[model samples]
Target: MLGSLLIANRGEIARRIIRTCRRLGIRTVAVYSEADAQAPFVREADQAVAIGPAPASESYLVGAKILEAALQSGAQAIHPGYGFLSENADFAEAVTAAGLIWVGPPPSSIRAMGLKDAAKKLMAEAGVPVTPGYMGDDQSEATLLAEAERIGFPVLIKAVAGGGGKGMRKVDAAKDFAAALTSCRREAKASFGDDHVLLETYATRPRHIEVQVFADSHGNAVHLYERDCSLQRRHQKVIEEAPAPGMTDEVREAVCQAAVRAALAVGYVGAGTIEFIADTTDGLKADRIWFMEMNTRLQVEHPVTEAITSQDLVEWQLRVASGEPLPLTQAEIPRRGHAIEARLYAENPHTGFLPSIGRLDHFRTPSDIRLDSAVEEGGVVTPFYDPMISKLIVHGPTRQAAAAKLAAACRAVEVYPVKTNAGFLARCLADPDFLSGAVDTGFIGERLASLLPPAEPSERVLQAAANEMVRRAGVPPALTGFRVNADPSFRVPLDHEGTRYTAQISPGAQPSALHVVVSGRDFIVFEDGEPYVLTLPRVEAGPEGSDGDGGVESSMPGLIIEVMVAVGDTVSKGAPLLVLEAMKMEHTLTAPFDGVVASLSVKKGDRVAEHVLLVKLDPSEVK
Candidate 1:
């Protein structure tokens, strides 16, 4: 076994690797950027090194700095935990060249599967079933358009080097293909530095099914079953589970065997995943499942696999890298129970899932289940990297039980200041379609309205707030003058998101069981995993602007990518004004109403902070 290892990543995954290393008696070294200097992972490691500034380009992505850090810390191996340089073939080769063990697949395997276009060709030649698509080398727009037309409508435009749902778009018709292609290529170039793309036929009911495969230097490979990651939003997975709900033994055998073959074909070693897009129109059939791409490193959703298989994957990776044979054969690996994992992100579901960045003034998750968190209470969620705050994993005797437990765990979450998707995840887990196992990639989009938390607080929540308020005021039950004909109650005027409501509080009423946190004058009540902020009415004056003011402000800190309108430009309501890139996603700000652009304050390539005014407009007088 490797004596010492360096984790070339940060956040939960880094901490996760450190945990396994500690159990195995392997000394661990952590490398962090300025932004993560005080992060939990850095403090937990036996040795630490500062790489560079906050931006990934200057820190995490700099391979030279990481290699130097490894040399300085005397780390014998480098483990690139999932993202950053995890799949960078050059980085893997560099680690080996420096005489340090690379705890990942061989560079050759990474290169073979790095690009979607080339990987598809290799899979097809190896007799592995692949999705129908165009992977040709013609870079002309005309050629892409022709391919889209030939393949029919509802085609998917995917970047050659894309992962994590970046650089991907789904076009439903011919008229939208060109614009979609342009957006896809631009994002691809920004994300992967490769604007090349390929086309695939979008399935009617797509389910993302992936099998975890491991290989050793002794030319032995085995499979660890499969996981279902179909519950997605904008092509990104929201929930994942092991032993897919509808998977049969026969189908599971077929997929797992195919995954092992793919690993052997690439001379793969260490942990990797083979993602397949399954058409579930008639249930999970081996024939309907086709290879999408290969992830050459550990996945973000590996916890679900670990929960069911009763194995530590990071230990396997280290053992294989240390020249050991497979720890367990395919038949020996056990699959015991159902497991589910939900990614808790620092983003607001009410605001189109825009990434939220701020201090975690109050943070608490259920203690019964496993939680891999990136930030702690009082820690700041900077806008420099992925917004995932933590991952909640639960295991149970059955899928239904696991889902029920996970839903309750989500509802028990109490986070304030920084918004999260806890409520959204709870709703998704409890939805009827999800509970019935009739889910697809488009499930969230189809039932979004029902899943979103209600705009206004319920009567129960208001009563809880009022009760808490009364308790805080130190008012006793006897203080309320005894009434002869009615229950003694007092009205409490409260404001919630600009709306005022009067809650009648009775000193003798039953105290609410709902969890409530007090932040100064604001009362944050958690109901069904949603946080409702209620405060006493203020006597301050209101802002002097109306909707007609047409002032546009940045929703979050981001870089301006495109400005579609200019000063004096006439635009209608909902017209795209500019594009802002934040948290690795693009958001287009639109006009609130029909108006003429009165002023512009930002340009392309300019970085702006949250709530900074970027544009102003004058309402159209003719209207």
Candidate 2:
């Protein structure tokens, strides 16, 4: 085992790796950027080192800075947790050259699977089932167009160099293929510094199933069953589970063998995942599955695998990197129960799932389940990293029980000030189709209307807000909330989510609480359960707050990555005006109605706060 190790990552993943190292008596070092100086991971580490500023380019992504931190901390090994440098082959080589143990697979394996086109060819040559795609070296526009036609309509143009759905697009017709390819290449170049892409046949109803494979330096490899990550939105996974709900024994055995074969072919070491796209239009079968790609490090969804197998995967990575053999053979590893993981993100599902940034006034989750979180009460959720606030992991004797438990936990979550997708996750778990295991990649999109219902503040919530206001004023109970001489039945004015409400709070069975009756529903207020924090509408008094004048505003705090309109340029209604990068996702703001661009206030590469005026159509008159 490593005497001391430095985690070359940040956030929850770094904390996760540190947890295992501590249990194994291995000293841990943490590297942080300026933005994360006060983060919890830094406090948990045995030693901490400041790498660079907040931007990832100057911080986590810099291999030299990470190496320096490792050396200064006397770390014998470096664990690339997952994101930033985990799959960077050159970084892995650099670490080994520095005489430090790289707690990941060999550099050769990473290089083999770094590019999607080349990796598919390699997998095919090694007898693993690969998707039919164009892996040719030609990069000309003519060649790509012909390949897309050959692959048939509804082809997927994906960047060969990166993952996380960054440089991927689906074109359903030949006319859209050219534009999609161009946009995909541009995003790919910006994200991975590679403009190359591959065309593959798009599965109509795809289920993302991946097999977890482990290998050691002793040339032995084994598979740890599979995880179904079909619940996705915008190509990013939302929920994942082990022992796929509808998997059969025969199909499971075949997929596991194929995964083991792929790992051995690359002489893979440590923990890795072989992801496949299952065409479940018919249903899961051995022949219907094809290799999509391979993640060359521990995945964000590895906790579900751990919950089911009752084995610590990070401990396996450490032992394997320290020259140990496989801890358990394929036959000896046991799968006792079902486990499911939901990615709880700091975003508002009611508002197109736009990422939210601010301080978490109240952040709480269930204590019974396994919650891999990084934030606490009063912590700030910056717009620099991924928006995932935490992951809620639960286990049960059966899939049904696990799903129910996960849904309950999500409902129990209490997050304030910053909005979240907790309610959406709870609805997903409670959906009948999801509960019955009839799910696919398109599930969220198909059932989005029902999942994101209109927000209606309950009477209890209104009463709580009104009561809190009175309590803050310290008014006597007899004189509270428009009370009369003797009657307690009175109307209390309150505001929440941009609307005003006059809650009628009367005396309750318990004098400590209030009874609010509205729309024939009786709601008893309490101090526990769902919080009722009133969000009074802000009344701005400057140019930024001007309304009813065709002034385009930024709805969130983010960086303006692309400005589509120039000053005095005419744009139509609903036309995209600019793209804002926030919380690790891009949001395109559009013109509210047809108008001319009279003035433009922001340009590309500018950081903006919420409600900042970006453009004003009637600027000449207003000024």
RMSD of 2: 14.4
Clashing pairs in 2: none
Compose the digit string of candidate 2's lDDT tens values, residues 266-308: 8899999999999898899899899989999999999999998
TM-scores of the candidates are 0.85, 0.81
Please give the CA lDDT of all the candidate structures.
0.89, 0.83
Clashing residue pairs, candidate 1? Answer: none
Candidate 2, residue 186: how far the Cα is off, in Å = 1.4
Global lDDT for candidate 2?
0.83
Q: Candidate 2 — which residues are off by over 4 angstroms?
A: 467-488, 509-532, 535-623
- lDDT: which candidate is best? 1
